[model samples]
Every structure is written in C-alpha cells, then in structure tokens.
Target: MNAPNGHSWHPETGRLFRLVIDQLQCTMCTLTIHDTHHAEYDIVDMFNMPDYLANRLAIDIDKSIQIDAWIPEKSNQAVSFDYEGDDGQDRFCGLTYYCRADPTVLLALSVCWQDGSAPDEWRDRREAIDAWVDAHLRLLWRSHRDRGRVGSLEHTLNLFDFTVIVLAADGNILFANEQAHALLDVGDGLRRAGHSITATDFDDAVRLQTAIQHLSHSDEQTKSTDAGVATVLLLRRANARPLVASLARMPPTARGSAATVLHVIDPDGETRPLVGELCRAFGLTPTEATLAHHLVEGLTIDGAAQAMRIQRQTARAYLKQVFVKTDTHRQADLVRVILNGIVPIKASLSLPANGGNGSARSGAK
Candidate 1:
C-alpha cells in the first residue's frame, strides 16, 4: 500500500517516527498494531498467532542483528524495510532493543515510517536515532534493574485491602482470599457458607443470589465493547456506614465452569465527616473534632496533639471527651469506633419497597 501521506518517501523527516511499537503479542495475550500514517489504517494490516514467533525471537536475539522478535529470515540488520510491509505498504523500520533487566520484555520502543522507505541519507542520521533509542532504553532498564522482583499471587493480592470472593453458579464458595475470610469473620455484614452466601437484608440476599445464578449460566467467554449485566449493591448496616459490593460474571475456564466474582469496598472507613457533622453526630467540640480527625489518620495521641498544635494536658482532655462521646475505652478501640462506626458521612440511600414483606429490594442490572 502507498504511504497515507500522499508524498514522496522521506525517511529522515517523515511519518515513520509516529509508529511506536509498544506491544508484542505472545501465545498468552492479544495485541493490535497501529500502522500507516494514521492509527486508523486497517487496509495493510497483518495478523498471526503461534509459537514460531517466540522461538525465532529467542535465537535471533543472540545474533546481535536487527531481527529481535518475529524478524523474517531474509532480514539482515535493522533500520527500514521498504519492500515488505504487508505486500501493499511502502516500508517500515525502527529499533527493537531488548531489556537488560530480564530475559523477557513487557514493553519496547519502536519508531517507524508510514509513507515510504527510509531515504538513502539515513546513514548520516542513524547516529541521532541510535542516541534517541539508547536514552529511552537505558532509562527504562536503570529504573527497574535494582528493584528486586516478587510477583507471587499472594503478594499481589495482599497489596489491595478489598475483600474478594468467587463462587460457583450453585452458590458454592469456590475461592475466598485472606482479606475475604477476615471480612466474613467480622460478622453480621456478609456471611459465607459451604453451599451459598447471603447478605444482612433478605432482599439483598435474593438479589446477590440471582446475580450469581446469571454468572453461572454465562456463555460469553471474551470481552466486548457492549456492557454486560452486572449487579452493584450496598451492604448497609443500621449502626455503621455501608460497603459497596459488586457482583460480575467471571468468564468460564477451559473446563467449562463459570463463577461469580464478588468485590466489596469499605471507602467509609477512610472518610471523616465534616467538623459540623462530627460535632452533631458524636457530640464533640471543635477542638475534639480536630483531634478525632488526626487520630483517624493513624496518629498516636501524642502525635495527634502535636498535629493539632495543642499541649499534652489539653490534648488528653480532648481525647477523654472524644472517647466518652464515641463510647470507646482505649485509643486503638477508639480509632476503630470512630473510623468504622461513629461520625460516618453517609449518603442518602432509598430502595423502592416493592409489594413484598421485606423493606429492601435488589438493584440488579
């Protein structure tokens, strides 16, 4: 295909530099390439998926040639290839350096030409391009070289504080991570059993179950632009703020069993009510509210006092009043009480009362 620019090929200063090749698809994942003078070009496109590309990149990398990954046998060194861009495109070229930090690379830098083949004058400008390539590659390598690697599943999951649980179509608990187990033991909010799971409200219980049932019967195995039917519900408590809970269908595995994934977020635990709201809810003075805010940020009593710019004696008095108002005895327990229970800034939530005995209903999609 002719260059989309509709001009004579000028490799030194042309559209080639815009063709950045960031993704290299393997047998594991999908990848789409941007080609031509525009990201929208689809006429000269090519597609391939198999093990041959992996094996080729492995051996050619040791040869110190332009053929890093998926380079054809006829290709020698690098820069631009005028004759072989999908048999219709004029040409393409760019650097394909490997990462020094590891045997595999998740990213790379490739600047290509879209309109025409590289000019014969590329020999004089090759050094400039080399400098550009070296600068970016070295920066990437140095940034990741010294930080040791630990990519275990547990390490990754422990980094998040959300409670996640996966269940089979029949409501059988399939997988529950460490945070999920702890949340289940917290009591009264969400309960898990060998057979099924339930929420505090009967209506919520039915809604969640029905959502999981839909996931169990899921047939779609690939992601699409169209949104699927998922359910988001708030796990409310009369005495404390609610948790945002979501249920979505996990695509079926190779063995053909689909499961439902449950996600719960406790954003309330990280929020502090406004000073007026805190004073009204827990009957604390302005100074006491300020102290409570500092404590909620995980500061010690002494630290909170210092943060609020108050004397030790005055801070102690404020803390005493805070404990009394919030109904907690110790600083640690007081922290939990304030953060998880007292002075919660809740949004007004109203669920329609359908013609049923229960006061709640599921807001499933």
Candidate 2:
C-alpha cells in the first residue's frame, strides 16, 4: 500500500498509542513510507514528541536513511537508531518495527532526554514491544475500517424522507437517522426517552417495545421462518394521523451490535413521488400526474382541486385520465399502487422544511 498523506491519520491510532505508552513509557509513531525516490513518509505522533527535538530531527536528518531503514524484509525484525545533538547534551533513541499486515507501514517507538543519559532498558524490552505490536495491529485496523463503514451508512440513511432508527437487543438506541431525530424532537407520538425510543401513548409504547424485543431476540428457528418479514405497529397521535412503524431484525451477518431497525412513516409528512416517475410509469400527462400526486398525499378530490386552484370538473377529468392510465379505478387503489410501487423509493428533490407538515411544490415536467 502507498503511504497515507500527512493529514490522513486513523482515529484508532490514539487508542493504540495509549496502550503502548502504559507498557513502555515512550512516544509511539506509526509511519507510512511512500515508495518514492525521496522516501516520502507520513507519521502519527501522539503529541508526545517535544517541540525542540521534533524541529531538530526534521532539520538534521537524511530523509532516505532515516525513513527507509525501517522497512524490513521479515516481519519480526526491529531496526534501531540513535542521534546526538550538537552539544552532546540531547539524545534520541528509536526502534522501528515492520508492520506485518502492511509492508509499507512502520511503527517507530522513541524517547528523548535532555541529558546525555537515556534509558537503555528499551533494548532489553524489544521483544516484548514487538510482540505487542503484532498482536494489536490487525485489531486496530479493523476498528478503523468498521468506523468508516458506519459513518457512510449513517450519511446514506439521512437522505431518506421517513424516520429510521437502529436498536440493540435490549432496545437501546444505537443509531437514529436525521428524520428520526426530528421526529423525536417534536415529542408528539414518539420520543427518545433516556437511551431508548418510546411512544407517548401507553398502549402504543407497550406494543412498540414488545415488537422491538421480539425481533431483536428471536430464536434461530423463528428467524428462518420470518427472516424478511417486518412487524408493523400503529402509534397513535392525539392531533393527527397515527404513525406507521415497521420493525425488523438486522441480518445475522451484519457487523455491528444493531439487532433491530425501526422504520416509521408519518402519514402527514411530505409526499415525495417524483412527477417524472408518475408520468413515465403511468403514462399520464403532467397535469394528470399533479392531481395523482395530491391524491397519494391523502387529499380528497375537492381538497386536491382547491390546492391546485383548478375547477372541480377539470380536476375530475384529470383524475379519470390518471385512473385509466394507471389501470386503477378507485382513489384508494391508486394510492396503494403508487405507494407499493417503486416510485416512493426514488430520491426526493428536497426534504420538508417544517419537519413533518411542510409542503413542497411538485416539480412536474
């Protein structure tokens, strides 16, 4: 592998340094050597290197010899180096070990002293330090990789219009998407209490808790029979439509401790079916598609006509065309077809500004 740039330090490096410091009382630096003519490299120092010694080392070292000598043909070899300052008052000692997992990477353990005297015990403890590095190197790399994957997944989930929350087996909140956070912030039907999510209503809370637990802790035989199925619960709201929440178990092969995912859909939330999608799928004109969009958003025919500023008769004419093109004769079936189809899964142009009740002008083309 090529060398990481100066700014590219893995977060797990700090934890590894903490462990190393406790054992050796030395500064730990992980260097990635570039396969270049100048032997360019990057180093992660845990802020343990003193400013004076760091400046002197940068100004007074031969780049090739200082960096390239660390690369070993065998994994177990340890290379040592010592430098004396101009007055012979400052001394520096470092041991570089080859990384078994990545050939281009090197681990340098060093210490500096103001007086000529420095600890020689590092030489005796060389074997112990090398063994510790070999044992923890792979684990730290895995942790860094997993953290990156989780960050990417969180960003992807934030793009959706509905709420998504991931929970552990004990119903603790492991992750919550942007929409879920907003939903909990409002404290209407559902809210986050302490570390877990709960419904405001007594009965709804019981059902929600039970569903999460069952899906999270189901036995192997039960999981096989309902592997892909999601358990649905309706959470009631005093002022508006009830929220629909679907709970499902994360697959056994998933990496993290997240055992259940709750997907909550608010009925009054912004409807995001694209006008182009409706037109292409149902072969309706833009005007007809607009009317269909309003219906799917839970508007009655009169309400849709009023919202569109069209005459009642004109709206009825558009609805008739939409029904014939979509092969659905009733309003309920039209909504069912659109919701159950692939249109709702398409990315929305924008999120609602008012959290749940905001309206966006449909982009009809």
Candidate 3:
C-alpha cells in the first residue's frame, strides 16, 4: 500500500537499512530482532549509534510512556530508552516502535534523535516517520501472525525498559512483553505460593479494566470525557521492584476497541536524586525527603517502600515527615515543585507535515 507520503517501500531489509542510513542523516543504524510475550518486532540496530557522540544519548528504555493514538484502532506504548552513566546530558533520545490491535509487530525505530548534524530532511519527516513506523508494525504483524511462536519480527522490542502489551478495543490484556510479564506476575502466599497472576493483578490494570468497560458501554461524548489515560507504577523484576505505570483511554467505541494504552516504567535512575534534591532544597527530613521523592516521581507509597527496600509502614512515616517539612497542603503541590525544578533540554526538527508529507513506509516495503 502506498503511504500518504511519496517514498516507496524497499522489499529488501538490507537495502532498506542502508537507505535509511544514507537518506535519514543518522550517524549510524542497524537492524535486529525483538521478541516478547505480547509483541515481537525488529529493532533499528544501534550499531552505528555508538560510533557517533550523538548516539550516546541514553534512551530511557526503562521509563514507560503510553499514548492514546488519535488514529483509528491504534494506541502506542512509549518506552524510554537512555544511555547509562550519562544521565546529566541535557539532550536525550530513545526509540519506541508502535504496535497494532492484533498486537502484531509495528515499526521498530528510534525516536527524538539528538544528533546535532542530522539533516533537515530526516527531521522534516517526523510525522511521516511515525506513520511509516506504524505501517511497518502493521505490515510485519500481518506477515508473521501465522508463524506464531516459531517466527518473530525482523525488529525487536526490549523486554526491559519497554512496555509491551496487546491492546483491544476495551483495554483487555490481549498480551504482554517480557518486562510486562516480570512486572505483572503476582505470587500466591506460602500456602498457594506457586500460583501467580500476571498484568491483570496490577491496580492500574483493574482500573483500566473498569475504564474500558465504562468506555465500551458509554457513548462517544461521555466516553471522551470519561475516557482518559493514567500513569501507574508497578513492582517489576523477580524481586518485584517498584516501577511506574501509565494507563490512558483513547476515543471510545462500542466494538470493545481500545481507546487507551498502558505503560509501565522503572524510574530507579531518577529516584535517588529526585528524593535527595527535594530534601536538600526544602530542608525536608530524610524520611520526608525520601517519601516526597517517590510520591512526586509517581510511585505509590507502597511502591516507594518496595523501591527503597523498606517496609510500607516505614515508608509511610517518611511520607508524613515530608508533608510536615515541605509545608505543602497536597501531594500535587509537591510534584509540581519538583518537576518545575527539573529543567528540560529540548531539540526540535521540522518535518514535512504540510506539503512534503512523504511516506517513509513506502521505502520500507
């Protein structure tokens, strides 16, 4: 299918990769396979990324970002990708490939490339690139659906630092990625120890289930107002460490279609600093500082405890201390203060959204 953009698909992967490297003004790129429980896709190899200083920008793959796509029958899980040990860098970039309703592979590509020398042409096609990537995911899903577990996408999705899920019209747990699996697995108590529940156990997951039901039953206008996205942080890893989660409802429909997407993220990197910074800046008690940090950073009190490797009660004490010290009336104020203090370094690229709407997918095929 011809994309709204003019570029034609390249049948060969090698040719497509090479063309992307040459035409897109990226310092370097590679292709690889990404597999997970819910979704499988190919990845744009970062082979060339290491060669260029620009590539070192960490993609916060651990951070979860889910967006309710305005497009029909689609939603996106934005995974944060980041370079480790370079957290202080002002500019950051990561790749998040989009997947479709069937949970089939979508385009696997990097996003927000921070390379300073990147050409205008590459930047100009941002929307087209998104569209193309979306198309790739759909095409790849179609190509591989029959193969099942035996086949995977030419691209890859990171189990860690990424949120993978099969979206339905009503936000059902169609499927999930490795990271999602590790996160959602809830072990039974000693008596029922062996038993476990996956993503369905999450508080946000249940909320999402409720929201989906409401959206599916409600009319469009009611659903639109009622339907919204939320961010939730869950406990991840075999140890069940705390991570952030986001749940968003898209425009509603009665077909049980997903109007929203859910994302889970690990904010361990920003946790300590965020906490310590609040304490130092506000003279908060250590407990207050710690509690303030986690709460503001989007962790639940329980999640903060698990993250801090402390007991929930102990975490609660710290939270109270934080409240008293900060002299803040609400948690929202605390979050606002800290977020405001954290500066954002942004880079912009003009894409051919208006006239030059070239299709990057056409080249991929």
Error of 1 at 360 (Å): 44
Summing lDDT over every window of 10 consecutive residues in candidate 3, give the lowest-scoring window: 188-197
Per-residue CA lDDT of model 2 for 1-365, tens digit only, reads 23323443566566666766555556534433233235444443434555455544432332534554534556556665676756666666665554545444343333343343435675666677777775666555566558889999888888777899988878889889888999999988999889999999999999998888788777777766655578988899989999999888886545433378888998876554444464455566667778888887779999999999999999999898777777779999988877776333325543232222211213222
Residue-level lDDT of model 1, residues 88-160, one tens digit each, is 5434343343223233332222233334433555455554455444454445344433332323554555545
Judged by lDDT relative to the true structure, which candidate is superior, 1 or 2?
2
Indicate whether candidate 2 or candidate 3 has the larger lDDT: 2
Q: In model 2, which residue pairs have backbone atoms overlapping below 3 Å? A: none
Better of 2 and 3 by TM-score: 2
Ranking by TM-score: 2, 1, 3
lDDT values for all models: 0.50, 0.66, 0.46
Q: Candidate 2: where are CA atoms >4 Å away?
A: 1-45, 51-71, 82-91, 100-118, 251-258, 272-289, 298-365
Give me the candidate number with maximum lDDT.
2
Q: What TM-score number comes out for model 3?
A: 0.28
**Model 3, position 160: C-alpha lDDT score:** 33
Candidate 1 vs candidate 3: the lDDT winner is 1
* Model 3: residue 129 alpha-carbon error in angstroms: 26
Order the candidates by lDDT, highest first. 2, 1, 3
